[model samples]
Target chain A: MEIPTQKKIEMLETMLLSRKFSDSLVELCKIQGKIPGMMILSTGQEAVGSGVCAALEPGDVIITNHRSHNHLLSKGADPKELMAEIFCKKTGCNKGKSGTLHLAVPEVNAPCTTTVVGGTLPIAVGRAFAQQYREESAITVCFFGDGAANEGSFHEALNLAALWQLPVIFLCENNLYAGAQRYEEHTRVIDLAKRAGAYGMPGVIVDGNDVQAVYAAARDARQRALEGGGPTLIECKTYRCRGHGETDPQHYQPRDEIKQWQEKCPIPRLSDELVSSRVISSEELKGMESRAEKIVEDAIRFAEESPYPEPHEALEDVYV
Target chain B: MQKLGMGQAVNQALREEMHRDPNVFIAGEGVGVSIHVNPMFPTTGLLEEFGPGRVKDTPVSEAAIAGLAVGAAEAGLRPVVEIMFNPFFTLASDMIVNHAAKLRYLSGGKSSFPLVVRIKSGAGFGAGCQHSHNLEAWAAHCPGLKVVMPSTSADAKGMLKSAIRDDNPVIFIEHMGLYFAPMPVPEEEYLTPLGKADIKRQGSDLTVVTWSGMLGPAMSAAQKLSQEGIEAEIVDLRTLTPLDKETILSSVKKTGRLIVMHEATRTGGFAGEIAAVVMEEGFSYLKAPLRRVTGPDIPVPASPPLERFYIPGEEDLIKAAKEIV
Candidate 1:
């Protein structure tokens, strides 16, 4: 699949924005002198989210795991409300009910993101089931980590999705770790995409750091889904630069491996590719970075200015 | 009015709701197949009537079934999925208890989760401990989910209609023992609103607080107690979570005596919740110590005679009522 210059530039801009958004969160935590509870960042895997989500249209649904800011941003989540949700403010997308770990933006069709490892897989299948049941043309994109593949629901969901020929793309961002447990040690399957064959769906592995590769694979899968062809499992071999959460000190990880993945940070890599290919100049790339930084700054300001929800507000959302 | 079994009434409700709303659909293992071709099974003839799109027969995947309902509910569709039996509910609890029950609250009430998880429960048919446990208390304890258990055919039809239309996740538990028993059901459309307790029988001597399978035994015990001039008021708590505390406390206030009854075992049964509610709100109204007529805290035995011995029966309800009276 040949990538268009405009789409390439758009992907670069999304990756830069997502990276800045994540960086702002870390900076905010530093200023607060504490990491907010249950905040998981997708630092080095920005390209996978940007690529896959860029392939999705407006009506497509997205279900992701705890490391979800990049996916939400790539799907066009309002950064202000997302940041406010992290700040536990009333203006947040979930009205302070779901913090960073369980953020959901319904307007962007990214409803009900979970922190549970394999929790989003089945839900994604159901979403696709609804789309097919209604005879709608749209599809669902489910994003999970390498650890989630080991969950029984992963097998169950893939089987059901394939059996029913539901319109869903199972995107596994293989970040090499399932919350401090190395993927290789946790599961015998080194290549998670190979497991998709057990369910009879096309399984493709892509260079997660290469935004173009991830985007092309997701676009083809989406096309197949729209054509009534069953679900596809696309495994993006990616890596997370930081500890599972902000608290870990990286005792379990090998320093050299972490250094290697960090060196391939997708944001700068995509920017360099766009510049070297003459699709965009170095000055233009610099301008995009500053623009992304400004948006992050504005989002932080909005989140900081938002008011905390009242104590009674906690009881309001327990039911319909 | 027509005499219909609980399963037939549930079928009527599902058929009516599915016809009324295009967004409504039902899915389960063998839902569309003929294994449960008995008329008493709710999904009988549903696939033929509604077609495969709405009546989905899934593989033996309970987690996916529950998650399918949760996801479909979030995506502007009302999915009424089945979890086969109560024990299989454990396999699906991560989705039911954790995801389906908590998603609405986690979304800050912005998302309306309109789905019904229908599971067959109770300690009859000698289905062993795995299949016959009444775990309504487990679902009733969850905050964002509504728990409903209908004892009569009328209630089965009426409450299911309300559950399907309600803008929340509802755990609709059907008693396996009650499925075959025919009861009066109105031909006209009617709904039994959730969170309201029905007075199965009105009397002043004592209040029999019960729900689901125990309602049958409690009513039988109520009939037996009337011979001795003890008029027992049976409070059937149709919905457990949005518990009809009003009716329970009112019955307790009137009778000044209460006996909580359930087929579930004594330990951590829903009876404890009713007993505590009465103790907290209507303690002064009590003339005698409140009693709990419940099964022993053990797995429901597989043997028919042993299971009969394990389940709380009319004898137990009568004994408890007599003691409280």
Candidate 2:
């Protein structure tokens, strides 16, 4: 896949925005005592969200996991409403019902997020089945973590998608840790991509920190799905540079591993590649970073100013 | 009017709904070939009429079946999925209880989830504890789900049609014992609205509250009571979630005596719910103490004689009605 200069710059901007947005949430939790247990940041995994979501069209659907701020922003969710949603404000996307865990932005075609591991896999197949039944050209993208691969839903969803020849892309982000346990401790299969072949689908491994590689793999997978070739499983190997949650004690993750992954942070990596390749200058990269920082600041202000939902509002929306 | 079995009525409801809406489809294990051969099952002849795209035969994966149905319903399609038996519903409860039941509210009431899950319930076939447990109370306990259990063939066809057209997720439970029992059904289009109780027998001496498989035994007991000048009015609660408390109170007010009967075990059965409702709202009208007759708190036995004893029968209803009166 040939990368255009403008598209590369856009991808770079998205990755920076995701990093800034995620880091702001972490700061809010650590410094301001806001969103305590809800802060599950995807700071090091920005490239995966930016690359995969950029390849999707308007009508395509995305079913993501709990660590979903990057995917929601990359898929065109409004930052102000998303921030307000995390703050439990009435102006939030789901009217303060979902809070930070389950963010559903139907306008962006990202229907819902499930906090349960591997819960979105079978749903993605069903959404793809709907697309196929209607003869629509769009596909569904399902995102999960390394821990979800061991779930029974992973096997059942993959086999059903392949059996029905549905248009779905099962994108697994292997960050080497399922909450606190190491990935190796959870499953014997080191390379998660190999499991896709058992379901009669093509599985590809990509560098999750490299935006261009992730984009190329996602673009090809989307093309194959649209052409009626069934689903594809793309395993993006990455690292969680921070603890699983804001309140998580750092007693389990080794310090050396954290430093090593921080050195390969996706935002700075993308900036260096873009500058060295003459796609943009150092000043332009700095300008992009400042712009993203401003957006995050404005979102924070909007969330702080938003009103909390009334107590009586809780009784509503339980039924249609 | 024509005679139709409960299973055949269910099939007719599915066929008519599919013909009315193109987006309605059925998916389950052996829904295409295995179930179609029975001719009276709900999926019978659907594969032939709707083709393979709509009538999907899947692997024996209950979680996938239910999760996919939730996804499909979210994507603007009406999916009527099946969970083979009531006991197996536990395997798919995460999707049905966590996702499907909560999605609409999670979406802030912006999304309309239209899906129906047909679960076969009851123990008359002696399928043992795993396959024949009555768990309607479990489904009714959920806030977002609409639980419906129809007793007669006519009510089965009418309520099944209403459940499919409803915009909320419905847990439609059918008893295997009533599948082949023939009853009079109207040929013209009609529907039995959900959340309403039916007066199966209109007597005034006492009120026998029952539904689904227990309605048969209650009606038989009511017939025998009539010979002894003990009139028992039976209130068949068609839908359990959006319960028809108005009808129940009215029936109790008229009869002045109450007896709650169900096929499930006595502990934590839906009979407790009915008894509590009568105690709270209709206590002043009651002439005698309420009686509840239910299965013993034990797993359903597979042996024929033990199974017959395990299930609530007309004798139990008669004894309970006699005591309450």
Candidate 3:
């Protein structure tokens, strides 16, 4: 379960990159309103995406939910194209069709992101089923929020995945709140992983803010899935620091709760871990931050320079 | 040529396609069971031939079935999924309308969702309102979906094959009434292309455009109208979306009149779409106002006598055609 020092640094770097991407979006949104559509920022939950996606191979599939920019970045989706997509440019990953919420990067095996809660759970199972049918070693990882667990799709997907022993990892990023509704208010079951036992699958809970812990759990789940051990539900106890959307009001969440979660931010926590462990110096961590910032800046510039899709382009891509 | 029931033709199409491509698999309730043992199911004998891996029987989870199909299709497999009844399709509409239909477009053509959803529709065998509804209009209204309804054995075989090969998601509708009806089907390989209409019976007096379960009634009405000196041409719109507007307009140009018919309810039916097309493009060609012979705007009745009244029949088409002619 122990990750190498170099790998740990890389994880920290990926988390920083994801954070910088979201940070750039927030800044751009404030300055010029450059985003063509609504933004679903994955600010506080970068480790869940970084850790889970880091466990996946090149061919492994991951179906993500609406707040999936971090998942896409961690899965190695081109930041420039993703930024262009948010800018509604022709050079974007989805050719300006799918904005932030519905971004897809098939090159990285993340084909689709559903805006509907828990919608992609069964889809991930299906992909795993196909791989199992073909006897491929690839697995499918599904990322959803704690709120999505209440959806019928989540239960059905788990049941089928277990019944067929499909190679799928049902990774629940338990961000505590489902669009401002706290987990306690939404469901009686406080531990989402416990529900996985009902479906006859291993339920493992991980520290969502700890990159190494999340990565170890995801790695084990992926291994189990690929070996025909059926699906595993890995619940990462995380938090979404920002409001649901860019313009979401702060009336639902208390300020104290936000401050507490913000203090436990995955990026700084992992950076501190790396520094305290003497795996990297404080200066090295600062260098990684600047590198991530530069990447985000380059991506923003690329998006700004990209041309908008022609009016007639809207009629295209409806079919083959 | 071989005489086969519509259901048998559908089974044949699936068998041939599965045999031809290793990537094609079918999943649905009762599909894994032998159809000969269970006469009510269309996926007879597929399980025995294809084995459990290719022929899967899932729990009654429509949403999961649809989502699985989209996922499998995107992951490099051609999945043909079945919803036991048309009404049950509503449960899966989120996946069908939002995922399967929009994935290709949302991916900017990076993904091809070659998924086929087959549902049995229409009323006649006392299946009641829930099991006997035609929602082809609902499917055709979606821009990214191709809706196809086969009325005959040949069309059922041909269109199903074409739908499996299609790159986009196709909503393949089979009528409950036509399941046992026998018609001649060619043994040789053939495909009825999507977005094409078939001229069932040609005439010059008036054009009667219809499809699916209504084709038989429309043809019968056309036959009766011919005896009355109104030789009504029957245009079966095999594919609803990407409609064969050219054939419909050309038929109207020749006949100088149009009567659109369908088993779905009259209001907001696909007939209205066809009517609009004819009105917009063939306005000058119309010798009479566009007429429609469709089921009344109410849920299909459970009782046979009331159902008979609810469903548009040969007499209804004949009346509509007479009004236009």
Candidate maximizing DockQ: 3
TM score of chain A per candidate? 0.97, 0.98, 0.97
Residues A86-130 of candidate 2 have per-residue lDDT tens digits of 988888888888888888888998887888888999889889999
Chain B TM-score against the true chain B, each candidate: 0.98, 0.98, 0.98
lDDT of 1 by residue, A214-285 (tens): 999999999999999989999999887888987677788999999999998887787887788887899998
Global local distance difference test of model 1: 0.90
Ranking of models by DockQ:
3, 1, 2
Worst 10 residues of 2 chain A by lDDT: A29-38
lDDT for each candidate structure? 0.90, 0.89, 0.89
Stretches of candidate 2 off by over 4 Å are A31-33
Q: State the lDDT at B256 in candidate 3.
A: 95
TM-score of the second chain in candidate 3: 0.98
Give me the displacement of residue B60 in model 1, in angstroms.
Answer: 0.3
Q: Regarding TM-score, does 1 or 2 come out ahead?
A: 1
* Docking quality band of candidate 1, CAPRI definitions: high
